[model samples]
Target: MARVLHNCPAPAKLNLFLHVTGRRADGYHLLQTAFQLIDRSDSLDFDTRDDGVILRTTAVAGVEHDSDLIVRAARLLQQATGSNNGANIAVRKNLPMGGGLGGGSSDAATTLLALNYLWQTGLSRSQLMALGLQLGADVPFFLFGHNAFAEGVGEQLMRIDTPDHWFVVIEPGVSIPTAAIFASSELTRNSKPVKMLDFSGAYIRNGRNDLQAVATKLFPAVAEAIDWLGQHGTARMTGSGACVFCAFETRDEAEAVLASVPKKWRAWIARALDEHPLSHLQ
Candidate 1:
């Protein structure tokens, strides 16, 4: 009998704060950000098949199969591993794309991790992370599977424990192109680094996303979302984003705001998870 695979979740992430410290000669921006996992997630299921490598899509509505990162990651892994075994992959998209949730990247990382195990590739975590970085800067961090402090084009990661809390994430139904925000001249390219302890004390007051101002100026929806959420509590962009989030002491408090969220926007109440969704995997 063929083994039946169960579902594996790929959770979304929120950047507590993001600061651009400098730019490298290679054109990559040096960044400082804190990544915190959320309860909200996308899920994937896999079943091995004798066929070479086939990608099956179960993407969210309006997401094209050809452009889905999960499929691309699967194909990339198959080619890179030179493995004869292939699996049928199905994705259940729950998180929004271009929302600064790192949904796509998380899905890709989950794919690589799951396939590595199921296919008996026996790749080490570091090896998988190295492969993941080629897919996206955020991919490596997701593979690390814990709250992290990231730097160096968002590739360098240091695991950290974040205060536990619930979050109200609001998406203003707009997609901000990350590349456009990164390329904008208005982005703050120089920022002083702060130690993790400094952030833990008063993250909201001291931490900031240098790209937020630039993004808000270009996308009023982002500004609107931030402004709306700020009224309830501290609100900030997760990354180069269209989604803005705020922390709440309780799920009920977060839900209260989620209920009042403007109909024109999208909102979710999520528990902040200290560990990454894939942390349990060997």
Candidate 2:
């Protein structure tokens, strides 16, 4: 009988603070940020296939199989290990796409870890993380499986301990394209960098997302969501744009604000995770 790993969680991440330090000649924007793993996630079920055919049995709307990060990660690992085994990957997509929650990247990271175990590929953690980087910048962080202060093009990670706070994440009902945000002329390319010791837990209240200004001006809903969430506490855009979040000391406080959120928008309360669910698996 083929082995299977069911209901693996691919948790979303929040950029507690995002700063663009500079831009490279290759056009990759240099970034400094703290990635906070949250409880909210997209789950995947991996069923082993002995015939050596990787397939996404369940489709995510608007994402093609060939283009799906989950499928790409699976195929990448397969080729890397020269493994004849395959998988029927099914995803229960919970995180909103293009909301800056690192949904796609987390899914890809989870796939690599899960498949490596199921296929008995024997790839080391460092090897998997290197493979993840080829998939996406955020993918490696998910594989790192801990809260981190990241720099460079978001590949440089230094593990950090973040406060245990509950967050209310609101989806602004609009998808913000990361490329468009990064390419905008109005986007701030140079924000003075700060050291890790300067990262107080309340940094999000004082710090900013270098791309938020550009995104808010481009997408009014993002601004509106920020303003709305701000009513409860300090609010900030996580990554590029669209979804905004505010932190609270308790789950009740977070949920209370979530309950009052406008019905037109989608909202949820999630606790910050100390590590990725697959941390033990790795």
* Best by the lDDT measure: 2
Please name the candidate that would achieve the greatest TM-score relative to the true structure. 2
Off by over 4 Å in 2: none
What does candidate 2's lDDT look like per residue over 1-282, in tens digits? 789999999999999999999999998999999999999999999999999898999978999999999999999998898999989999999999989999999999999999999888988878999999999989999999899999988988989988899999999999988999998999888799887777666665688899899999999999999998999888999999789999999988987898899999999999999999998884
Instruction: Please list the Cα RMSD from the true structure of every candidate, rounded to 1 decimal place.
Output: 1.8, 1.1
TM-score of each: 0.93, 0.98
Candidate 1, TM-score vs. the true structure? 0.93
lDDT of each: 0.84, 0.92
Q: Candidate 1: lDDT over CA atoms?
A: 0.84
Cα lDDT for residue 145, candidate 2:
89
Off by over 4 Å in 1: 59-67, 195-201
